[model samples]
Target: MVEPPMAEKDTATMKPVGTTDPVGITVVVPSYNQGRFIDETLRSLLDQDYPNLEILVMDGGSTDDTVERLRAYGDRIQWVSEKDDGQTDAIAKGFARATKPWITWLNSDDVQCDRALWRVAETVAADPAVEVVVGGAHYMDADGSNPRPYPTIDVGPGADVRREVFEKGYMAQPSIFFRRDLYERVGGLDRALNFCMDYDLWARFAASGARFGKVDADISGNRWYETTKTAGQTLDLYAEILATQHRIFGAVSPYFVQAVSDHLYGRFHSKFYGDRGHLFFRWLYFKALWTVINARAPWYCVKGLFCQTIAKSGPIAGDRMTFKDWRDGFKAFLRHGREVRP
Candidate 1:
């Protein structure tokens, strides 16, 4: 491995890979004004168990302590502060400068598992044809407590992608590593999209007929704080996601049709028959259910029905759902069919 250049000057004590390996990996952290959380984010990357790694922190001209915090990290990370379009563009610039053949992005507020790079490297090493390796991820609080695992996408055995992955978003961007060549081949992320760039990129990659691999272990943690974009723009994000799917998979993709039906059902029930919060809750429930049902597998409609049942029973307090509740709701819906009230 031609040991990639170190981000910081003090690498005398750190283990360095000899210049003999065929592949090097880089982890890019695309940040904005995340001064309070960027330190923890970079720490997680620096603590990774994998050897022969590069850490690149690219910021979009932060006017806060984000730059000062980056400076504090010194040589541990290679960082740059300048204006850019957004996260996607920053990531592309980082990837272009990376000396590694494999890369993954770590959002400024997200943390990587201790074994993330190790697992991704192992997957890539095992399969020369694999263009992407995705693992599981969970959402956690800032202090690393209160974990809620993201839904898993079952891509099944083999190098090919199943329709279910695309339908249900099989690969979480933060939890996956990509081959540099494949990333470039797909034209990287869409700078135009503030949200759903991950979905768009994943769709493009899947459409290319590239090979994919799965690392069964959870390799990343996403934080769900109020400052996160998803918190403020749920409906907007949903619309972007729907639109992205239509554009990438074609307007008539089964996934689009399923989304439309689920959206209609939930929108009607929640907006007309229930409170505003309940409306959004129902939309998520039905969407998750739609994903499961459309997976073309039996017993997958549970996720969709799980949340809707709670909202139907009363008001929604927060965003949370369980499989058992969904299963029960699914059964109830099937039994009553259209006769049941929303």
Candidate 2:
């Protein structure tokens, strides 16, 4: 691993200040055919002004202008554009080359918030024993507008981080950083997984008894566009997540079962009813009834489905919502015969 450049000096005393000997962080950006958005993503990291930063862009031989844009960065970043298996493969390759003490990956379409690296470094520096650091992030639209805070929960000491992640599915991938040693100890990412690989890594970290720390401030922006891999594949994503959980924990959680059922209904509703019309209510009711009749834990599944429905129908903006707000949103969904904004 290459050493990061030394910190800049203060004008008055000409002595290094701020992050003079900050912990190094390597950001691996796995990309392919993301020419339109890669530049902004790179700039976000470059502008962090964090001295101890290393960036690696592993491109899967993008046919777009992504290579040209990468060339523009010159030596500021290390990159390899070649044919690879997939996103997971590219990220695994980058991870293998990561030389920094700490490591994380930011997707080609995502951007790091201002000073995010600094904040992460400071948090890790404050507690050198912390093996993982999780922060907040926002869900941005395709055009980078309409930013909404992604759901985040505090995973303090002694907290069941793995259970919270499996049940709530709230950890933002880009907002997470971990020690390279922990990654090595956990055997890094599973190259076979197409989706939910990040979730799998978190599960491994927690199961291994890794110490976790949280940063309350938003540290990344995760773009959610129609063409993205996770956009219309809710059912598949959750399925993979559940599979990973089953493989790791030897049993899948009820929360994930409820999630699968809800998304199953969503897939059916979107395909047949276009997600609107009076048929929406009928489909939802039928799905609930089907769950009650067919599910293993019928009552728990029904209750979880009910709670998720109300929660998903809550106000479109804001990170948190009250129960009353969720109930009103559900009422609005019932009245309008469509899914409410969330």
Candidate 3:
């Protein structure tokens, strides 16, 4: 594997000026052609007041100025810009090099909330048994305006995480913090998965009997953009999510099918099909959804369908929406065929 040379560790920027504290956390950022958001992403981490932190940046060598931009940090960050495998591979490489007990990987285009590390550290410090910590998240534009709270599932140590994750699919990666031991136990990420790799890892962790914890506050900012992986690879993401679901359940459950059908994105996809779907194809699509929901999930899994699968406020202008507008959007969504990224 090709590797870029490292710089002398910049103790002044990463640590708390000689304050004695635990080697609490390490964050790995993997990037390629993400120079625009890279600065904000680094600043979010550097601005944290936590005592001990070691951040590593693994770049999949961009043709852009990503390396030069990172060098501007002047050793505050330890980074290597070189051509390597895909995003998951870069992150898995980062995991191999990280030494801190707590580990999490942030995308180059994303940033954390103010002092996000402090909150995460406290949660982990309080409960050593908590292998994974999940906090809330927000969706902001590239310009960083119009912040909105993203509702996530509230799960605890004893919850049925495997079932919920398979059915609801609410585990957000940005706001999650996990221990190093757990990562090793679950065998880290599956590099083969382009999308939904985090979900796959989480399912494996649950399957390995790892307990989860929840933080009741927003810990990071997940920037929403047209170019982000999830946005550009919606169809692939759906397939990966289903693949993960099937891997855990041994078969695609009705609950899972219903979960997909009742989703806003799936609904839009359904409409997208309705506009262009051949008669037989349309029949197959609805029949597949209906067959699964009625056979395996209608009575059992869909009771909580409205809980996470569908947004309560509706997808467009979530609040202040009328039934007629909802009706029209549902119909027009198919006619106009707006692009949906998970």
Candidate 4:
């Protein structure tokens, strides 16, 4: 497949700075009817204490108390509460109005970690060539409690960002900070995608040969609940992600296919053998065999199943598991002839 053009620095927008100088960052927050959570989200950024920062809230004309909450912020944040197409549209509007050199977006339901902005700024300021800064995040429950580390793989030195993003999908939207010029250069977020716009943007950023830096700390808290878009529309999300893979690489990655297959198996198992404890492993084995037969590469699929079962290297969206953990779980599953939970 033909590769996209390389990213070039925008000299007109690039400003020289000292090592000690703070880098300006624009954070775009897209919201709709998230009155209960938006306040905390706004407060997280406001409390960052980063010397140079801009917080813009783009509300998609929420009918709830969201507008009142935005008004409560007063001049602390730049906001526009009006009708917009959707979350992607609101983010586009906010990005268009951004004056800072570095930019990122946080959903109204999510909150940035303490001093997260400082970590991002310091990384960017230390290396002027770094166009993207990727940090870690935590999965918070609906009540914003029990925060667990979100699996964020470090794109190490000389690692291919495009390959990692395309194959493993290893970045979190809330934990990402990138340069405004680099974003504009990569053509920004795709308007057509309702679910995987951030993933598509990362793929484009990687394809453009943009340099990336890692912040080895949790930068944001991504709240997870049944009502959330990600939790509710998981199948649709995977469909969008697969479509994005095809669009970027002209072929779907086997790792992504394995992830899709695993998701399908889980749904099937839940529907057919969820309550029937005896038939769990039987259905799993049957599904595995069927998946191998239908997969584009049968051997690759079999190997993936083994590695996923052992090394736990299928997808980065979920918590990673080690070989020893998987081996112990497998032993228990075999001994009881039932499904095992890790």
Candidate 5:
């Protein structure tokens, strides 16, 4: 595997493009009615210690005070207010107007620290070969003081990078930066997808042989308490994302189908199956899981769902297991290292 780009560790003296600082980065913030938080978002970006940078805001026809807040920024941001598809579409439009080489986006409710841009710029400038640079991301609810560490993933160049991404989406959107070339190569964000567009874009990039670099520094502040669509319309958005994934990948794509199946079981089980799906429905759930896996890959399905059989024997009616049965079996295997041999 080729070595990924290395970023600067110390406060090295390097000249930034269009400035005497160090590096140039374009920060994009996409907003849709996040009125309460848009001011803070803009303030955070403007307060960045990085000297040479452009902040762009793309609004998707927000009806509330979001447009007013954006207007307050005036020429500070290369601002564009218009009707667009959704968050992903708004981001794509912002990227089209980006003039800088390094790019990253923060949600309207999210805020980057004053030094976040400077830290990211230093990292990217340290290594010329690094195609993508990602840093640590933490969650902030309302205020900026409290922080909760979020998972940060780095997919460096390798033969298995695509396989890993296709199997599991490991990176978060807010904590990422990469070259405009890489974005263009991966075909930018999918405008049709309201949510999970970032997932699809990352998968496409990884599949196309782009290398990822990691910085131990924190570069993003994610706000989880916002009324984001992922919080209100998870199931529907996931369904749309799954359909899009099938079209982009194939019907049998492991990542696409497995995620959809897991989500279906998760949402339904939590809503109805007993305390978490109903005892009777549990058996049907496993049977349905078996059916799905079998339809996708028979041998693989049988091997993976074998545990469902033992955990659902009490409420078993047919040749399948219930939701609780499958849950218990999976839990046992995960916690006790006990596998159901079939």
Candidate 6:
């Protein structure tokens, strides 16, 4: 495995991590200017009852009180505040230093759900074959009303990793953990990608045939404040998702056909984004619609058009239906022998 490179190096003393208790899981937190929430994030990690857990935080030279705030934790956490390349670089640096067999990373603004690490550890302990463990998450935004359950695709026996990841959407970053071997095999997160880096990594791991487990529980509290990395980059997010998948799966792979099929199903099932994506999205939608149409799969482009029409009638375009409405529609879409299993 290549040493996770540090894009830049500076003279910054590493935090004096207190004596660890035979660490089994190491979570590398990559943070920058997230002082408002970093304390809570650290608390969630420290408060985990899982004894053999270690916290390695990599800060990209936070100008805020992030360092001062973390200082209160004393030697409890192993940390370094320095000038690094970026979030991905900081993560790579921390990952290289991690000695735990199982590893995960949490951004500074995110908080681990109640007993999240414990649940992850429990699941992985029970089934060593399950290389990646993922759970649902509570997406919270201060401006938005309240936190809501962001459903994750069920990845397990007989699951299609490509379709679920590339098409189904909604994989919680904070709620995921994988073995170190998988990390080393895939070469960790790609430093070149600013957006969709996690998606790219997941795609490669899936292609590598890594086993997956869904915890079926909410394991992360992901904040979506104004300054969050996700807030901007809407265009880049959409473009990179397809580009990364294409780079690996090829432009004409049948997997992409399934992706379009899945997207169309979502369109009818209240999952489509109306007139808000790149032109290629429309082209893909048409092709996928043709596939379902020719197969007589009881799913058609017209149905989604009708649904979109209804959506635009009352509220407006681009507004999502309530979770209940979307779930109801999805059940109908799954009726045509396309249901995915957990």
Candidate closer to the true structure by lDDT (higher is better), 3 or 6: 3
* Per-residue accuracy of model 4 over 129-200 as CA lDDT, tens digit each: 899999998999988999998877557688878888876776778999999999998888888888989988
- For model 1, the stretches where C-alpha displacement exceeds 4 angstroms are 1-22, 159-162, 252-272, 275-342
| TM, every model | 0.72, 0.78, 0.74, 0.78, 0.73, 0.69
Over 188-289, each residue of candidate 1 has an lDDT whose tens digit, in order, gives: 878888877887887787888867788898888899877678776756776777667656653323344344444555566746654334434454555654
Ten contiguous residues with the weakest lDDT in model 6: 1-10
| Backbone N/Cα/C clashes per model | 6, 0, 0, 0, 9, 0
* Model 3, TM vs. native: 0.74
Model 5 TM: 0.73
Q: On residues 1-342, what C-alpha lDDT tens digit does candidate 3 reach at each position?
A: 111112222465553333325446889999999888899999999886455677899999888888989999887879988888899999999989998899999999888884677767656656767888888889888888888887575576567876666546565688888999889887789999998889888878777877788877888888888988888876678678777766675544434443354453345655665533222232234345545534444544354333322233332212332345446555655554555533
C-alpha RMSD values across all candidates: 8.1, 6.4, 8.9, 8.3, 8.2, 12.4
Please report, in order, the local distance difference test score of every candidate based on alpha carbons.
0.69, 0.77, 0.70, 0.76, 0.66, 0.67
Q: What global local distance difference test value does model 6 have? A: 0.67
Per-residue lDDT for 158-190 in model 6, tens only?
888766765454588889888888999988888
lDDT per residue as tens, model 2, 1-342 = 111224556777543555446688999999999999999999999986666789999999999999999999999999999999999999989989999999999999999985788778778777878999999999999889999989875687677887676556568999999999999999999998888899899989988888899888899999998888988777678668877876777555544554565456565555675544323343354446446533655565566555433224421223333456546646756766544435
lDDT score, residue 55, model 1? Answer: 92
